[model samples]
Target: MTLSNTIRWLGMLAVIGGICRLLMTPLELMWGTDNTTALIIGGITGSVFIIIGTAGIYLFQAEKAGVLGFIGFLMTTLGNILVCTMVMIALFVNTALQDPQILEQDLPGPIVPIRIIMMITMNLGYILFGIATIRAKMLPRWGGALMILLVLMTFIPYTDYLFAVVWGLFYIVLGWAVWSRSKNSETKVSVTQ
Candidate 1:
């Protein structure tokens, strides 16, 4: 429907996806075996999260989002797509071929560079996006600043999941802000009309 609605829904998806990701480790532990199921769930949700989250961030005020925001969206989205594709392949191999050992093997030579690029792009892109969001002033200042800070925080040991949840919360807040603004604007227009 409206751009605000789209962003709201996408933000919800990001939240759900983040929760799914956070569950992966615990689920694997409970199952006490293969991580195939967890990987599949995480990969699917993670893909949705990254793609939609990037779009919501990029389109928040596209005209004012700036070059860094654009680059951030492209890099993060592409990197997530690549990583998700690899995860899907892993799922297929584990399920169809019943070969978990394949995953243990070192990635092929060609894939190594791609993995490195994905890591750099996904991390750097989000950082830039956060900065751009702050500069654009489309969302709350603290939300944007938190985004940048959370991304940086991921580098700390044992904080990946913690920051991920916070990141998802940021999306939720941004989505609510956009949705509320749109609703208020619509109400004002109706009254004037």
Candidate 2:
């Protein structure tokens, strides 16, 4: 119910979602299984993070912080939600219902334009969120910085996917940082009491 509680929940969700994505990527690469299945799994796993993040965005508005940081979080949440939803659609509608060969062989119909737009928006949202992280004192500066780096790398045509991997590592580290910070803050509060 409290702001801190919400953030803690969000962090936990991010941890779970991030790990799921990380795991799914390798499975896709190694197994070459159904791409739709992978996206659906990833999307479902990521939905938790989106739910938590949505709450975090609302909570952030009530807390004191710079306008930039607020905007960054807002953009980050919006972008994540947008991308996640797109991925889900792609998975269920495109990959699940339509011929899988369309995507695999680039015989695309509706997916190409939609995916391109989603990718652009999602990447931009992530980059902005990373910048916001730098401004917000709730997390480490390095996490935000790393996100910016990931964004830049992701835009480099061929290296963007690599950035996605790096982004996953950063997500785990950020989650650990959040959990640790929450514990430490609780200890301090208890000690003071």
Per-model CA lDDT versus the true structure: 0.66, 0.58
- Model 2: lowest-lDDT 10 consecutive positions: 184-193
User: Which ten-residue region of model 1 has the weakest summed lDDT?
Assistant: 184-193
Q: Residues 1-193, candidate 2: write the lDDT tens digits.
A: 6556656665666666666656656656764544655665555565556446434432432243355555655666666666676666556656556655444556456756756665665566667666666655666668667767776785478763454466566666676566556654531111121
Clashing residue pairs in candidate 2 are 154-160
Model 1 segments beyond 4 Å from truth?
Answer: 25-29, 32-34, 96-105, 160-167, 186-193
Residues 122-170, candidate 1: write the lDDT tens digits: 7787787777888878678776776777767867787744654565566
Q: What is the clash count for each candidate, in the order shown?
A: 0, 1
Q: Work out the TM-score per prediction.
A: 0.73, 0.73
